[model samples]
Target: MFKKIVMFLYVMNLAFVGNAFAAGQDREDGLPGMPYRTPTDKEFRVCADPENLPYSNQKGEGFENKIAEVLAKDLGKELTYEFWLDRQGYLRNTINAQRCDVIIGMGSDVDTLRTSKPYYRSGYVFVYRKSSNYNIKDWNSEDLRKGIIGIVGESPPTIPLRDNDLMANARPYRLQRDLNLPPGHMIDDLVAGKIDVAIIWGPLGGYYAKKAKEPLVVVPLPEFKSERNSFDTLKGKAEFNISLAVRKKDKDRMEMIQGALDRNQSKILKILDDYGIPHVPVVLSDKIGN
Candidate 1:
């Protein structure tokens, strides 16, 4: 009887030891200490617009497409895209729905969306017909005093033009349109001496003016400068910035993304410069608001 009791206690001890060991192993496997675990087959989803240019398109030819490509390469994941027309439905129907993990081409200062620190910078610009005598290199200078300045209706640029006393005396009119002409016909008119100067996004103005065979020059507007362009995620994901969105529970994935972003910052900036991404003015956000 004594021998049997001893044997039973020994077997019980062995079973307890085995169970403890198994539990420890399970804990380690579940939450292993590592930078970031290997991603599953389908990890990052790049959300983009099908028709937006210089930003993204279905054909994967825009700057955002190129950025997504580089990020995917670094993450060792296959890239996928959620293509949707850019509109109010973009965030609710697409990004927030998890159709895609990230949204590129978002404004850094947008209150509704959370964004990363400034990645690139450019500014709204003044484009003029080459023959126009007005040279508006500086928005504060008296140069703008000499001619009519055309601007798109209800744009960020309108704020500055209104606040500055420079255009105070001059009447502001909508960029005129002609019924008999196709779209961008006003640009043609500008080339043929119909309008003197216009304010526009630097990239579009520069590209289109050149495309239109109009000898035009570009000048950055002073007040509306420094709009930082960044990728956006839903609000409150500040710790896991949308610079690279991952599953909220995936801390490893977020760290890997941060690592990739840090490693590729220089290359990213170089690509942006080479392509003239025309980002919003980045450094001057605090002083200027619209």
Candidate 2:
């Protein structure tokens, strides 16, 4: 049922992003600079997760928040957030529905919205307690079958789990586990020995592993033979090249963001590195047509 809901949300997100036009001139949806002329609004309103650290938080500490500040300064706007948890209809409820104007980190593959050129690319990773001496890197590892693995439920990482029949013994992290709690709570579980291993999204896993109270092993998943890279393959529905998304009809807004992003690419990457995100170099030519 969770999977079905997520799939539905994915489809709806694409629809909302691709169309790009304002819903209705008669309907006011809680934002400015749409359905009319150039936006002179002084605020650069963003939609983000309040507790999803390493990505975003209300205090403006996440890498995305730093990047947003950079962009705001570049564009001469003030940064503001519409905080939402990463839950069902996140895209539909916030930016897509026009309750907010922008999202800093979204995959570029969604054809629904006009996404900025990807700023960076990353993949999933395997995180385990170093004290356990577990060094499994691939799903094909025999040790994986014997271990009590942790995975965020209904996420791309679960695909390899299902393919290998590892769900029965898995310690599944509910997608909406703790709204008030910080994101990537699984790493703490690993530290406490509540779980033997965790397959986590790269940014969260890499960041938390470095921040763990005790040493934890973090390994980027190897590319499956059938797939090109572990990150791209498992998250097959999308690429890891994260970008800012805007309503499609808002081409002017999109261009403004794209330019700002390009101008500050170096600073943005440094922020990501500080968060310990494992990613590939961005090919600007590919993200933006040369």
Candidate 3:
């Protein structure tokens, strides 16, 4: 469900091509020979996905869209977007390619971009019908073994699911799909009783659960340390801090964004609450690495 989230952090890093600029430049926009164009004072150019929701879409209805509006308003600039699909080559085609000045939301640990201070933190969650009365809060629950589970293939939760021997009864959904397609199908199946439970990213699960006709339960998984010598793909970290991103050379733009985020923090949080997004406190001491 959060293929966009995972791909943005891990896959996009491969698109970066190392660049060097001369030292002691007087410009705040770009140094003498920088590749990308700096953002102008008149417009806040944003790189965004046109169809992913709970995050972004063309209609400007997602929480990221709302947050972008807040930032742009605070910065005294008109908001504009370079719409792209959040898939492989996304960074190569958009921000890194110089199509936009900022990405409204990205994982804070992504090495390919200069990310701002995190605005919010979120993680994967368990979604099931409230009628089922399943009080599952962790991966060790016996109920998970008995029920048919739905999960996005290759996501962080899969590591624990496999370790618990629950893969035999689990159904996997595609992580990457066509650009025009939107998410929330797994939660749709859960509400229709096609699956007993859905283990998905928190924002996706929470938004869909709030929209479901039948009441659904959303439980956040507790943080756990990855075992030493473990070969799990995600290293057992389910939560992550999300931040705005700029080109590696755009430190000025990053600092400007950070100021806007600090000034409008409450408005941004209100937008997340209005969208039914589930979030956790961003604890710097417990920060996860790339």
Per-residue alpha-carbon lDDT of candidate 2 for residues 72-154, written as tens digits (9 for 90 to 100): 99999988777776654465556665666887876555555667888887766888888886658677777787678998665
My TM-score estimates for the predictions, one after another, are 0.61, 0.76, 0.84
lDDT, residue 141, candidate 1: 56
Instruction: Go through the candidates in order and give each one's C-alpha lDDT.
Output: 0.49, 0.67, 0.73
Model 2 TM: 0.76
Q: What tens digits encode model 1's per-residue C-alpha lDDT throughout 1-290?
A: 11001111111221101121121122212232323224356677777767555556789876678888887898888888878655433444454554665554443333233334445555556777767666677557566666666664434455556556545533343332222443344355567766667665554454456567757776665543322323122111101111333323445554565666677877776666655534443454321111
Maximum-lDDT candidate: 3
Give the clashing residue pairs of candidate 3, or none. Answer: none
For model 3, residues 213-240, the per-residue Cα lDDT tens digits are 9999999876554564254544656787
| Comparing 1 and 3 on lDDT, the stronger one | 3
Number of clashes in every candidate structure?
Answer: 3, 6, 0
Better of 1 and 2 by TM-score: 2
